[model samples]
Target chain A: MIQLEKIEKTYTAGTVQTPVLKGISFSIHAGEYVAIMGASGTGKSTLMHILGCLDKPTGGRYRLDDIDMVNLDDEALSHLRNGKIGFVFQQFHLLDRATALRNVMLPLIYAKEYPADAHQRAEKALTAVGLAERMSYKPNQLSGGQQQRVAIARALITDPAILLADEPTGNLDSKSGTEVMAIFQRLHRDGRTIILVTHDRNVADHARRVIVLKDGQVAEDRLVAQPRDAESELAAVVDEEVRP
Target chain B: MRTLRIAQEGARALAAHKLRTFFMMAGTIVGIAALTVIMAVGKGTEKKVMKRVNAFGTHAIMITAGGGKGFSPPQAGITTLRLEDAEAIRSQVQGIDVVAPFAVRRDSSTKAGSNQLQTIVMAVGADWHDAWEWYTTDGEPITAEDNSTMARVCLLGTLSASDLFGSQNAIGEDIQIGNVRFKVKGILEPRGTSPMGDEFDRRIVIPLTTGMRRVFNQDYITNIRVTVKDSRQIESIAKEIRQLLHERHHITPPRDDDFAIFSAADIAKMARGISGTLTYLLIALAGLSLLVGGIVLMNILLISVGERTKEIGLRRALGATQGDVFHQFLVESLSVTILGMVAGSVLGWVVSITLARLTQSPVVISWESFALAIGFALVVGVFFGVQPARRAAKLRPVDALR
Candidate 1:
């Protein structure tokens, strides 16, 4: 569960103050699949950073799982992030020198109580992402689509409370993008809470609800009557390629 | 366990880039190797100096009848030194223990039965044995009676006895010293080579009175050996003896005194020749290598930190504390230096053995060198590693991610 009350972020350089997020408020319950959409300069990145607990809002109260993150110190925030939130970056920032399995097991290295079955858990996560045969492969050895899948496996290995994806399909081809979307739809159906942040309308339409930001404020927040089905789109793409 | 895991990550990075790690370790290797060699050579030189000092007699000072720097064999034909000078030093000097005046013949042809050879022969008083701490191992020593009565008995050194008599016993046998036949009374104890690289075991000894009256026919002795009660006061007593000699001989500073005095301390200095300067130069080399090595290690680590900014951000986002990152970098640095220390120690050991074999000198390798090397490695590792670690830990996650 997450809650925001008038979250505001301002950057200061010398004597000049620049406000990035102005009086933004939102709430999302557990197991909810939602998308936050905005163009560049609409404070989309600033809000995403706050939501991921990477940075603090200058003026606001943000509660994730009943703990107000505003008062937590940097060290406590890191532990909180490890325990509650899993992140999938647009660049798929996996360690280049590490194997896919090692990348998935990275979060457990920083866990307060390292699990004894960490290796097995990483294997299962990688298998769930359709990378069972490529567990030992490095990032450079994987394609764009497979690298993204490895990043997803890494994100889910900790079994965090919420999954936050920032432009998860931005760097993939159309076919890989559809496949990634299908995986997300399947996760949503399995009662997992998902927060998808992107500027693409087509990407945001895959979620059950969408919130759009304009000029550092929420301009639209509504439920989609009929969300696009990514599984069928992937099947259609495969069929089109096979027919040729 | 957490720290171990983080340290493992640092080790993995080093393993990944082996050349970079080796470059970081180069300076430490050279510096520690030089340090180890210096310790070995220094300890070996000190041992040699002690041995030579002990051989020359720690409590004795020799006043040779010659005007020259450094210890040399008693200058032949310098007839100014006499038995009265030995008596004056014994009566006038405060710390005098025994004063024995002796004359030396460098090349004297001697014969025993059919064997004949040329060797040095010393004419000494009864106190010479106490003054040199030398005594006959197998037969009677020269006594005051022998010197007083001008006895015809003489002592043969171990080598000289073997040279003149072969396997047969030379004691109670007769030997000729420059056509003067004398009966051998004893075999002197074996003494090793002198500081001047002459064999002390290959010489003969006779009573001073007999030598002056019947043998060489010289009235003046060539050397006065003074043994002091306290070895610590030997240098000052030598100074006093010099002044007494200067006044007795009526010589001033402008006129070079026809005498030279040498103590055990001078022998030590002579034995340690050139090694002191060599040690100082090695110390400078060791210091410079360590200093420059530490600087190079620090600069490379700083550059590595800059290059790994993205990786740092990723680790931070994955819940690594700044302390974890700092610990990782510090571990990386310490590993390089510590590993280099081990390699350098082995290299130094090989070089030390080669030096000992090639130069035929003692090279002592002790545990202290290894301990000191570890100390230096840890110091350089920690000193150079902190700044790069701090810089890495200070990077903000958000900014670093961008």
Candidate 2:
């Protein structure tokens, strides 16, 4: 669960003050699938950064699971980022030198939790994302689709309560984008909370709730019907019936 | 465990860049080599000088008569050093071992067949053998009976025999010294040349009575040589000898006494002073080389830090502590220095040995110098390595990543 009240963020570029996020308020409950959509420079990414605890809000109250995140120090914030939240970026920023399995193990290394079983858990996460066969391959050796799958696996390896993806399908082809959406759909059905930021309406359609932003303010919030479970529908296929 | 993993990673990275590592170690090698060679030369020169000083004989004191002021008329045809003075010194000085009176007559050439050679003929009492521990290679040394009888016999030095006989045995041979024939009794062993390049084994020895009665026909002697029981007591013994000689010569207040006392200990001290100065100069020169090597290390490390910025950024993003980065660089520098030290030590020893052989000088390597050279290199490594390591450690992860 996450909450933000009137969060304001400002940037100083050579003595000139620029405001990115102004008086934005939002909340997401556990196991909820939410999508935040905005055009370029709408502060959607900045909001996502604040929500993930990667950056601090200049003026506001930010609480995650009733704990005040705004009051935590840098070290404590890093701990929270490592232990409570998993991130997936648009470009799938996996370490270039490590194998897919090793990239998944990075968060566990930072948290110092389940160190002895990290390899096993990483393998299981790779299998969950249908990447068990490519676990030993580095990011450069994988395709755009496979690389995104590895990033998703890394996000799920820590078993964090919330998954935050920033433009997860921005760099993928249509087919790979559909596959990535299917994986997200499955993760949501498994009772994990997910918040996805995108500028594409098609990507927003996969979520149960959509929030649109304009000029650093939330313009619309609506509940939409959940997309079909594409993987399970394919799994339910049967041979041609006699009447057909 | 984390440190170990990081160190291993650092090692792998260093190994990947072999040329850079080799270049880093080159400076250290040259520095250590120069230090080792300098120290070896200093130690070897010290030993050679000390050996030369000890060659004059330990605990032996020489008392020479000085030319006094014009007011004190010179004793014409008189020898102030007499048997009485030798007796008094032997009887009064508690630590005196032996005392002998010596007189010398300069002879420019001695004729042996067709060849002529310069020589110094010294007449010494029989106790000279006991006082100086002179050994003969052939016949026996001159005895007390020979002194009493004034025998017409002489001892030839190694060089003197070689000049007279041309490699032939000269034990029973005769040589003419100032129109008088004296039979050669023994040949002395060759003592190497002095610091002044004077050949010590180029003189002849004869009985004191023979030289005075047969050759010069004078009853006076030139100087007295006194040997003490122990080298440590030479100073006290020399003082005693000077006091006794002063009293025997009947000089009051002893204003610039009739004799000057010289001890081997004094010569040894002088030699030590010269060698000490040389050693200091060499150590300073070696220190300069080490300084240069340290500068080279600093330059190379700075360049390396700049070139490896991306690698450092990657490591930081992987959760490495700043202290870990510092240690990695420090270890790399130290490894280079240590490797260079070992190579330099071996090189220095070879150089010292080759120099000793070529120059015919004694080369003595001391353990203390070896240890000091190594320690200096390590200190230089640490001293010059810290700045670069600090620079690498202080780089911010965000800035470096960008």
Candidate 3:
């Protein structure tokens, strides 16, 4: 579960104070697939940062799993992020020198008690993302779709409560984007809490709920009548390719 | 355990970029190598100096005939230095211990049975044994009766005895030195080599009375060997002897005297020669290289921190503390220097051994030098590593991830 009450974030520069997120409040229960939708400069990235515990809100109270994150120091926040939040970036920020398996195992290295079966856990996570045969492949050697999948595997390895993805399909081809969306749908169906942040309506259509932001404030919050099924969309794209 | 794992990550990064790691290590290697070599040569030079000082007698002063600035052997055919001057030093000097007047003749023809050779022959008093602290190892020493009676007896140096007798017992044997058949009364103790690089055990010795009355036919001696009661007082006593000789010989300023005095201190100085300056120069080089090397290492580490900003951000987001990042960088630096120290010590040993073989000078390889090298490596490693580590640790994850 997550809660944000009137979160306000202001950027200070010399003589000017620019308001990014002004008095925005929202809440999402466990196992909910939600999409936070906003265009550039609409403060979606700022909200994502605050949600991931990477940055503190200037004035507000944010709670995750019944604990207030706003009062925690940087070190405590880092530990909280490692244990509770799994992040997938638009760039698929995997270490270029590390293999997919190593990239997946990176989060566990920072855990307070290192798991003795870390290698096995990384392997299992990579296999769950359909990268069983490409465990040793580096990011540069993997396809854009496969690299994003590896990032997904890395995010899931820590078994965090929330999977926060910021434009997960931003850099992928349509077919590859469909495959990633399909993976997210499968994860959502398995009762994982997923928050998809993106500027595109098509990406938001894959989630069960959409919260649209306009001018640093929430403009719409509605449940989808019938969400787009990414698995079926991916099959239709494959069918189209085979027919051509 | 966490620190160790983080340090291993640092090591892994260094291993991944081996060329950069080697570049970082170069300065430490050269600096430590120079330091090791300087220590080796310095210790070796000190050992040589001690040996020469011991050989020249720590408390003894030699007033050689004929004037010279450097420590040289007594000049041949100098008639001004006499037995009376030795007596004057024995009676007048305050800390006088022993005063032995002696003469030396080089290239004297000596023969035993059918063997013949030309060598130095010395004419010394009974106190020569105490003054030189060199006594006969095999037979009776030259006594006062031998000088008073003008006895036709001599002492054979170990090498001279071996050269003439050839494995035969040389004591009590007859040896002819320039038409005088003298009985070998003793075999002197073996002295390895002189400070002048001559064989000390290759000379022959006879009484002063016989040498002056029968063999050399001269009343003037060539050198006065004076030993003081205390070695610390040797230099002052030597100065006093020089003054007495100046007054007795009626010599003043601007007029060169007929004798030159050398003490144990002078011998040590001559033995050390330019090595002291050479040691200082090498130490400076060692220090400069280490300083320059540490700076270069720091700059490279700073650049590496800049280059790996994304990696650092990723790690931070993955839950690494600021202390973790700092520790990793420090570990990288320490590993470079410690590894370089090992390589440099081996290199220094090879160079030192090669130098010793080529120059035939002593090169002492000591564990103290290795320990000191380790100490220097740690200092350079930690000193240069901290700033870059601090810089890396100061980066905000939000800013770095951008």
Candidate 4:
């Protein structure tokens, strides 16, 4: 669960005051699938960073699972980022020199309660992402889709409370994007809370709720009674590929 | 467990830039190696000096020409030491045994048949062997008749005999010394070396009268060698001889001695003192080299930190603490220096061994060299690594991610 009360973020560079996010307030319950959509410079990414605990709001109250995140120190914040929340980015920032298995095991290396069966857990995470056979391959050796899958596997390895994806399909082709969406859909069905940030309307359609940002504030929040089914859509696309 | 993981990560990061890592370590290697060599050579010099003094024996004392309690400084004038002064010390000094007065002049050309070589000529009394306790291995010692007649009969040191005659018999053979013909009486046995690294067996010897009257034509002797009856009385004998010489030269207060007397222990202490200064100079040089190496390592690590900004952000996102990243960089530098330390030690050992063989001094490696090499590596690792590590630790994940 997450809570925000009038979250605001301002940046000042050499006496030039710039506001990135202004008086934004929202909350997401357990197992909820929410999407935040905005155009370029709409502060959607900044909002996502605040939500994911990667950055703090300058003027706001932020609570994650009944803990006051606003008062938590940097070490506590890092621990929350490491275990309570998992992040996926468009860049899929896997270390190029590390193998996919090592990348998947990355979060465990920093975990306060490191699991004893780390290798098995990493292998299982990779398999869940359909990358078990390519676990030993480095980021440079894998394709863009495969690297993104490895990054997803790394995010999943920690089994965090919430999954936050920022423009997850921004850099992918349609088919790979469809596959990724299918995986996310499956994760949501398995009762994982999800927060997706995107500028694409099509990507937003997959979520149960959509929140749109205009300028530096939230413009709309609407519940989708019947969300698009990503698994069925992926299957239809594959069928079309075979027929073509 | 976290520390081990961090070290592994550091090693993996270093493996990414193999050439860069190796070049950084090369700087430390040269520094440690230079330190090792200086220590070994310095220790070896001290040992050589101490050994020479011990070999020279404490019962013998030496008197040079100038250094006495007089208006003249030591060894400044044409030479005041005379055969009469030596005889006077032999008679007046109670502990005195054999007083063999001697003088040395260098750059005299000796010719035997067609073989010619420049050699030092030593003028000695007949009691030279008795004072030195060094004897002729072949024929006989210089006689009183030879000194009184100023005879042309002479003895040769082992090396000089070999140089002049090769494998031929030197005894009873004729050799030309400064255009004067002399017959070789005997070949003296080998006497190893002086504390100053000069070989003692390379000089040509002649009777004191023959050397001073015919060759040099000087009435005064340059120095006198006095052998005491007991080693315990050697120092006291030196003092008594000094007093008699000062009184005879009319030396009093407020005047520097025209001569200086050094017992065997004094010679050894002087040698140790000289080598001690050399050791300090070499350590300073080693410290300079380590500083240079540390600077180079710091700059390279700074460049590495700059290049790895994205990686740092990613690690922070993955739950790495600021302390974790700092430890990683510090460990990386320590690893490089440790690698260099091992290699530099081996290099230094090999070089010192070669030097010992060339100089004929014992190969000595002090424990301080090892401690210094290891200590420098650790200090440099921390000193150079901290700045870059702190810079990396201070990077904001949000800004870095951008």
lDDT of 2 by residue, B72-163 (tens): 21233556666667777777889877888887666536767776777778888988877767778788798889899988888988998888
Candidate 3 residue-wise lDDT, B90-120, digit = tens: 8888998999999998899999999987898
Model 4 chain B poorest 10 in a row by lDDT = B68-77
lDDT of 2 at A216: 82
Candidates' RMSD to native? 2.1, 8.6, 1.9, 7.2
Q: What is the number of backbone collisions in each predicted candidate, taken in the order shown? A: 0, 0, 0, 11
lDDT of 1 at A183: 89
**Alpha-carbon local distance difference test for all models:** 0.91, 0.77, 0.92, 0.85
Using DockQ as the measure, the top candidate is 1
Ranking by DockQ: 1, 3, 4, 2
Q: How many Å off is the CA of A202 in candidate 2?
A: 9.2
- Per-residue lDDT value at B125 in model 3: 93
Looking only at chain B, model 1 earns a TM-score of: 0.96
C-alpha positional error of residue A16 in candidate 3 after TM-score superposition, expressed in Å: 1.8
Worst 10 residues of 1 chain A by lDDT: A77-86
lDDT of 4 at B155: 89
- The whole-model C-alpha lDDT of candidate 2 against the native structure comes to 0.77
Per-prediction DockQ comes to 0.72, 0.11, 0.66, 0.52
lDDT of 1 by residue, B23-89 (tens): 9999999999999999998999998988788888989899999889968887778889988988888
Q: Kindly state the fnat score of candidate 1.
A: 0.56
- Give per-model TM-scores: 0.95, 0.62, 0.96, 0.75
